[model samples]
Target: MKVYLWVDKDIPNVYGQVAVRAGSIDEPADFTGLAHYLEHMLFKGTQEIGALDWAKEKPMYEQIIKLYDEKAKLRDPKKDKAKRDELTKKINELSVASSKISKGSEFPTLIQAAGGTGLNAYTNFDQTVYHNSFPAYQMENWLKLYYDHFQRPVFREFQAEMENV
Candidate 1:
């Protein structure tokens, strides 16, 4: 990863951005909105940040992933309405269960607690960028949080996030 630092003594806040080369253009043709969906999922947080009980949540989350995968495979929803609806119902059920053990929005909550602002990310045709500005004194906290963010992002609210995408 390439790191860029701009130090301005007069500024009270430090702005950090991490951009990845992959974006909508990188998604498989069949999975058009996947990149954007991923952008939303990244904020859901990792095991260390979002989960109150990862042990119990992991299996339920895996089931949700599997259901989504199956749903994705059934191309024509009209033709496979029964199967698709079944999968959708299961995904929703698992998501609700998973949410029970998840600390939803904890990632941004942490940043806000540390005096951060503009905590957001965007996905474009060629790249996806995550960024935020934090009080200069909170630089260390920002770095550690983002490091964990990229290293171990969990798809906690997949179905709900997909709706936003």
Candidate 2:
């Protein structure tokens, strides 16, 4: 394995997140919430940040589950927005107790901190990730925290993060 690491940490801000080895294409069958739900739930972190409070957030996550499910079959825009909005609200409410922080703001900070600039992300049918590369001096550190997040991320503000996006 090519163990990736960030070697630089100068400047100011530093943000990090993880991209799972799995993606929508890898979602299991018979499990409606397989991929998107897993994506949502993935933010539920490890022992480091704190245990995932699924009890309180389950309903909100479920709402996102519903939105995603409905959005998939949705052919009507009006109904879709309403459904999406409702689910988004639940997610926001639950986010207060989650670790699904915003990747948009986070990754850029990693770049800026390492004394580089500009960072962003994307998703496709097959996968999704946080991606940024910079000057040779800032290479590893620019990407370090992201890998760190992979091991111990808390899906804290997924919907809130989504709202900002």
TM-score of each: 0.88, 0.43
Per-residue lDDT of model 1, residues 10-110, tens digit only: 99988888899989999999789899888888999998899999999999988887787888789785899999888888888888888999986999999
| Candidate 2 total steric clashes | 13
| Model 1 weakest lDDT span, ten residues long | 155-164
Model 2 per-residue lDDT tens digits across residues 1-165: 244545455634444434556666775676544555545434433333333344544455456556557556766778577776766566545454343332323434545666664454444457666554456655466445555546655454445444443
| Displacement of the residue 36 alpha carbon in candidate 2, Å | 7.0
Q: Give the Cα-based TM-score of candidate 2 against the true structure.
A: 0.43
Residue ranges of candidate 2 with Cα displaced over 4 Å: 1-21, 28-107, 162-165
Winning model by TM-score = 1
Give the Å error, residue 80, model 1: 3.6
Clashing pairs in 1: none
